[model samples]
Target chain A: MAVAEIKIELKKGVADPEGQNTKKALELLGFEGLRSVRSMKCFQVDIGLEGDEALKACQDMCRRLLANPVIQSYSVELK
Target chain B: MAVAEIKIELKKGVADPEGQNTKKALELLGFEGLRSVRSMKCFQVDIGLEGDEALKACQDMCRRLLANPVIQSYSVELK
Candidate 1:
């Protein structure tokens, strides 16, 4: 069995409103002295196969869906 | 300076509509035999400080916003 670990790395300037809102909430809750926050998404899927073939399939997912290639980069670990 | 790495892991049955839609697109585009797909989000931030202090701040961010603790688990690595 092939396990695909998909990790998406978003650009620093992508305007993460969710992250920004979180920061404000944190400040209000007395988490003072905290400077910044960012968020990323990860996916682990079972490819039910092996090797480069599985890699290609997952990469396709990254390109077409898992991430916006224009704004993010993806790394895949096949285990 | 403190570097905070934010990772969000969503539940397996969280109804990833985006993922499902991606799967369909992949099949239509000729990539066959793909059974399932899942996705996650990650973030890396410079906390402008150091040590356990930063970890606590980031964890606060997770509890308040980075993740919906009811449906997700967050892990933080302070570097």
Candidate 2:
């Protein structure tokens, strides 16, 4: 089996409330010198396929359902 | 400034409904691949600090807020 790791993040200029809240929380906890924070999603998929086939499958998955192309971008790493 | 990317994942044995649903969705979409999927969260934090300070701060953030110690595990990468 092979593992495909996918990382998805919001596009630039998009507002991320969770990240904003986390920054606020950090500030409340006395952590300083933070310029910004952004949040994203990750996925680890175990597939029976191998090599390039695995990556191709994952890329299709990302485009079809894992990420919203309008506001998010994603990358897949197969191992 | 430095960027600290934190990837948070559910600890082994914890149920991941989202990943399960995603697998099902992929199958429904006629993508043939066998095995399992797991989901995680990632945070890209921009900090003004440098070197060890940034990594240490991010680790502290993970311990205190970014991850639930009982059910999730996280890793921080500084760039």
Candidate 3:
């Protein structure tokens, strides 16, 4: 078995309200020196199969549903 | 300046409906060999301040808002 870790984040130039809000909140909470904050989603998948087949399936999944290629970028790590 | 990456995930034994649904979605989409799926949130904060002060502030944020200590676990990475 293998585990595929997928990280999805907004592409550069895209505005992230959640990240902005968090930064504001941090400042309000007295946390200083914050330049910016960005947020992303991560998925950890456990695959019953290993090797190339699993990797391909995961890549397909990412392309089809896990990420929006137009607005987000993703990276996959298999272990 | 520094960048702080925070990863938050559900604690062991906690139920994750989103993950389960995603796993089901992958199977329905014909991606085989999926045993399970788990999801988490990742935050990337850019800090103008470096060293221990920034780290301490981040830790406090995690404890107070970024994560629910009772149900989730979080890790911080500084770069």
Candidate number achieving the greatest DockQ relative to the actual structure: 2
> Model 1 residue A68 lDDT?
90
Q: How far does residue A51 in candidate 2 sit from its true spot (Å)?
A: 2.4
Candidate 2 reaches a DockQ of 0.84
TM-score of every model?
A: 0.71, 0.93, 0.91
Poorly placed runs, candidate 3 (over 4 Å): none
Evaluation by lDDT, superior candidate among 2 and 3: 2
Write the number of the candidate with greater lDDT, choosing between 1 and 2.
2
Report the Cα RMSD per candidate. Answer: 3.1, 1.3, 1.6
Deviation of model 1 at B61, angstroms? 2.8
lDDT by residue (A1-79, candidate 2, tens digit) is: 7899999999989999999999999999999988898989999999789999888888988999889999999999887
Q: What is the TM-score of chain B in candidate 1?
A: 0.72
True contacts kept of each: 0.74, 0.94, 0.93
List, residue by residue over B30-66, the lDDT tens digit for candidate 1. Answer: 7777677665677776776678878877787778766
Model 2 DockQ class: high
Which 10 successive residues of model 1 chain A have the least lDDT summed?
A: A31-40
